[model samples]
Target: MKSITRYLVINISIWALLAALSAGVILTSLFRTSAEDAFDGQLDMVLKMLVGELATQLFSSEELSRPGSLGQPRFELPLSGWYWTVSRSNKDELVFASLSLGGENLTVESQSEKQYTGGIGRYLMGKGPDGKRIRILEREISFGPDQSYYFRVTGNAAELDEQIRSFENRAWLLMVLFGVVLLTASLLLVRTALRPLTKLQRRVRDVAIGKSEAIVGSYPVEVDGLVEEANILISSNKETLERARTQLGNLAHALKTPLSVITNEVRSSDLQNADMLVQQVDVMRDQIQLYLDRARFAARHNTIGTVTKADPVLKKLTGVMSKIHPEKMVDYECSADSDICFRGEEQDLEEMIGNLVDNACKWASSRVVVSLTEGLEEAAVKRPQKKNANVRKWLSIIVEDDGPGISEGKIDEALKRGKRLDESKPGSGLGLSIVTEIANLYQGTFSLERASLGGLRAELVLPAIKEE
Candidate 1:
């Protein structure tokens, strides 16, 4: 499953980027459109006002050189394109000028003959000898009979265009900042909302590996029913498995005595084919018993899913071995915490550990060392103390002997059911096979390696059970 943090971050990033792009497009378009409309309206009013001013000169028939008359017209200071002039229609000359031009010649276009309505005009703007870009409006107004005059008005648009561009830049900056903040907030919201789900997932994993009895944390309403149902299923399955194993074990024990009596009677028979028949029946019975043992091992349970101390199990096995093989001395050693414990069925644990320790005693000349530690190997011995049954923390039980070890190539096949290196060696190869089955029951693992004592080592590691 994907991690929640990464999932939320990716979704939030995409949404934030899209939102920023959308806001930028919309805000820029609106501001530019609104500013253009406002400027266009102002341009129209300036055109009309300039036309009225020029009409006065044409109606009075004033001298072309007279100050504040037809020759020189006063205008508002800081004039942009708000300028006017009255000129003779025939000569195409300027009859009067305005301070809005500051004595500069006006190169107005004469498009009046083509079309004479409100339209765009290009002309120089400002009062300097040099001019800048501006839009001009031109129209013909009649002052009196045979006294028609040309009126032109213009305004500087450079500053207004700069202002609009500046506004656009600010808008984009604000959108980027908002997008970042929105993305951060969105990620946090996602993480907080999914926190319970994360916990549920972890609890489920613990149950799957037999580390937890059930989900223990609070859940949101959306998932509470699901959790309850899962807990019920886990409980039911464990109970059913245990019941099946117990019945299988009882059946195996019930048949063992009958099978042994038949084998003893067949062995004493004098008939030629009777010995072969007896051996065959004995083998068949052993196979049935091995499977029965496996079933019994699988059915056991860890009570309340609590951890059982590893040192105690190891010490108990060593003590039992001393009595079982009184001639051999079994040593118990531990390198892990005395508090170290694991989640496992008690019977299965004893079965697996018993097999390993018993085999070590059978083969060892004198000393058999057993160590129960919490780690995968000697190098990994030092680790954090926090225990979790379904995860990395491991409770390793290692049993080593100083007897001759099995050949390297046969180790893998040795764990197979009914397979033994030495048929003459007492007891069925079923011991190792039973150990393997028991290890699997609790989700534990086992390996046979060369021991430090130059013999065989059975290394078993199981997940540590978590405390309630």
Candidate 2:
């Protein structure tokens, strides 16, 4: 399943990035517009001052010289890019100019021209004294009819362009910083908001692994209903299983009482084939016991939080088997990475392992070895999840004895429910079969193979529970 926290964070970051870029673009554009306006306003003011001073020179056609009270000292410097000139608009006659022009003329290009009527001048982009890109503002007025003059002022625009570029660089840097802070804050807020869900998930895992019986915590209002429903479901399932077990036990007892009476009556009688009747009664009893055990194991197979440590169980079983076969001397060995556990009912585990160990003891010459499989660190174990019932982990328990091993062809015959390969052994020939059945019920596997110790190897795999 996809994580909600991851989804929310990715979406928030994308939108924040887009907003930062958009804000940066808009901020720099407004700054550039204001810069252009200030530059143009200064040029317009200087043009007006020159036109007022040169009005007297227009009356008499004296060769033009620098006008007075221009106030800007840059006009005195050669090629300073601050200059004023007066010329005839209809003819190429230079009437007057500032010393800043250095005896060079300024010409405005007609293509990049704009006019502001009602006493405002015309503006254009053109070349100045040294071929530098410049902004020219010119005003034309007629002293008499047919005698008109143009007042021109030119300034280099490199400072204005540089100022705009510097502002854009600074603006983008600040926006990047702002975007980082926004994403970091959003991440922190998302993690904080989802902390309750994380706790709830851990609590639920604890229940599945038998660490807890019920979900308990002070949860948010959004999750209170879920917690209540989960607890109720767990309690109700336990109650239902308990009632079913009680009913099955009662039924078993009720039927067994009549069977016992019939068996005793037939054995006391002296009729023909009385022994055969008793033998049939014994078979019926065995069948009843087998099915009853199967029913009990099936009921507990899917129950939640039923974990059993294998070490204690193995210890107890090995000691009991030793006493059961005093001459065989059975021993238990645990080769797991740590204290591993079986993820099933304790009784089921006992039944499976007990049957294998007992069978080993019965067939061994003088020694029997029961071992828990090694390399448990590589094989993970977990509870059966609700959404995926087939997904499970396994741990192996093995029992081998140094006795006469069966050939590969007869191995299948030996696992049949009532097929005993050796009649001398005092058993019903159901131990191996019963172990196989129990392993199947727990969604596990059982196999018999040639033992390394020159005996039969009975390998039983069962669902396991281990910490991460």
Candidate 3:
């Protein structure tokens, strides 16, 4: 149930963290190798200088009791962790030592028996005097067949470690900053990349809420296919519903005439079962009409982009009502804002409003009033957290009459199918029931109360479409 953006961010963060960790480790290892190689190169240069100084001493015939300087001043400081020594290779006897050695010997443990040859030396890590770690380079030079000397130079390993540690700290800091910058850039890129999808989501929501008939917008190639598929689905659903409604209407029309014939035939006969047959045929006819009305209402329910102007439909219905019941001599008054509209099919509005007006004329003695208003209900405005909060603008149809109103306790029965308060009244008792069904299909409500004119007040509330 997680959003796409959140899922992408989580995955990207995990990968970025792992990439940072891997880069840090690799960089640390490379820096360590580079630092050790630099330290070893310094040791090699110092060892070569010492060997050359010893050759100079031998050529000048100087005594080997004291070590000669190799031009590095730190080698002269006692226990300064930089030292040089010369010894007999065969006996391991010290021939000369630097002052920094403090009269102690440097002992190196060799892992292999092979000696470095070809005028080159071997570098070793070993223990110095005072148990300090040191890097040593040892080389052997032969003055004659029986004379061989070992030249050894040592430097503190701690200095090399400190250099590597300092580089590690700065390198890791830079890598962390780089990772943060990359992740931030990635977040912005994701939002920008998915903006089309967000817009598409809004368009689809507009279709669901009856604001638009289809998804409409420009999209990236990656999402254009999805938009097309959604439009196709909407079209498919509408087509299927239309086909079902057509079939239901055809079936209703096909059955009505035959049923009417059966009822007429039974009424004309005098057989004992004629009455039973007539009653059964009449029930069948009512059921067919009821289901046909339901099929029509279902077709309108949830239909997108269906807007009906209320003023014209109401005005037309009032004119028809006067002609339909001229004997009653009922005076009709209708008032509505021209901009007030219903968010449903025109036929559905006509059906519901026509039934209410007809029912009012049937019961009214002299006067009937039909009014339309556009506003949010008191309960709807107070409880803004309701599911249909977007449908705040409601079109209210109020019909009132001055004839006798039904008792408040029997109002519920009036809405039920085939429930008639007086059998003397000329009706099938399905008028209010059909109105209620149609109102419910449009996600509206139908209610009855005491009219201001002393008859019944029939109020219908339906979602309204704004003029714009």
Candidate 4:
């Protein structure tokens, strides 16, 4: 069976991991983009400084290198990966350059750097004169109407790469940690959410197997509605059965007196076939009795649940039977646990055992052996894969003797109602039928097989319970 808690936990964990990974990707991208935009903004400021602050200084200088500090001092150091240059537009002629250029002209791989221009100022990534990766910002500036020069400012791209790489590593690490926390939280929440459901299932199963009358204890508000509905359903079912039993009893009372009146009137009257009428009336009474017996057994099998100790019952029955059949040596053996019990009314258990023992004593030549043993039913042998779930218990009773046993082919036939193999037995052949009917009511089995004691073996298996 699929577990609800396991299903919920697994699905929640999968979604949590997916969401965390997607968040990591998106967060890292945004961080890197913000850092890159800030880095480009600083470079753009320096480009403005070169155009506004040093435009006149460069135009009047003959050597095109007289500068103390243009924007930052790093541009004055040779091969510092920060430089600036002014060149004639529409030509590759350098007019003025920063000191950090080291006498080498500034040029881009394409018509510009590794990237293209968009608006007034263009951003590009390219190799600088120092053989280091740099970001270049280029723009064509006109000091007058005709004279135009290209201004380019360069900065180190390696710094931006390092900062973005560091942020990516940290972001992925945080995402992984958050995913673990999320999965852990999901596991706890799933178990907590399902705890009440698990308890309710056990209670329902216990009620089904006659361990409890109905669900017990308080629960969360979310589960209280389900508990109420379940209790209602269980109570309604038992009530319906009880009402049906009451109605059937009322019907019996309504019919029984009338039936008795007809039988008595027919007998007292001088009818042509008075004996025949009495016999038919007797049969009708027998039929009604049989119907009521079936109805009673039907009501009992679904009883809320009761426990009856078997040891005392077995001891009492065997003692009574020894005196009832003094000529026959009737006995009993119990290999079952001391605490083993029947999961039904004491009378039902007595009824099934009494029929078997009585029949055994009737037919046994000398001795009879009645034994009880712990046994597992064929259907309940395989256990359910659940925790705290009840496993049904069962027991077997075998009654055998030394008398002549019936044939194997007649075993099934003998269980039929009114199937008297030998009329000389002085019975209506309803003992085994009654036993079978009651056994079936408890969802039990009754069979006749050759006993090891050289006689018929009546093996009855019924639902049982432990004392605890």
Which candidate tops TM-score?
2
Q: Tell me the tens digit of each residue's lDDT in model 3 across 102-190.
A: 89988686532433333656777777888888888788887766668888888898888889899999989988997898799889999
The whole-model lDDT of each prediction reads 0.69, 0.79, 0.83, 0.78
- Sort the candidates on lDDT, descending order: 3, 2, 4, 1
Could you report the Cα RMSD, in angstroms, for every candidate shown?
A: 6.0, 4.3, 7.6, 5.4
Model 1, 165-196: lDDT tens digits are 89989999999899989998897798899989
lDDT of 4 by residue, 1-468 (tens): 278877888888889989999999999989987997787777777777777655666466544444456659889898888888877887487777888888886546544332433347677667877678887888888876666878888888888889999999999999999999999998988888888888888887678656788898778999899989988888987897789789889988998999989999999999999999999988888888889889877876666645678878877786777888886665545344577788777888888888888888888887778777777534324432211133367777778887899999999899998788988886788889999998777777787889888889888877776665
Better of 3 and 4 by lDDT: 3
Q: Which portions of model 1 show Cα errors greater than 4 Å?
A: 60-100, 105-152, 199-221, 260-281, 299-311, 330-332, 337-343, 365-396, 416-426, 440-445, 461-468
TM-score of each: 0.75, 0.81, 0.64, 0.73
Q: Which ten residues in a row have the lowest lDDT in candidate 4?
A: 382-391
lDDT of 2 by residue, 1-468 (tens): 288888988998998899899999999999997997777777788877877666666567766566853888877788877787878886368877888888888866663444644384677777786887777777787778776888777777777778999999999999999999999999999999899999998998788788999988989999989999999988887787788789779979988998899899998999799899989988989888888888888778767777888878887888887777876555544344356778888888888889888888787776677778532222223322211254345577888888898999999999999889999998988888988788888767677888888998888767676666
Clashing pairs in 4: none
Q: Where does the lowest 10-residue lDDT sum fall in candidate 2?
A: 378-387
- Looking at model 2, how many pairs of residues clash? 0
Candidates 2 and 3 compared: the better one by lDDT is: 3
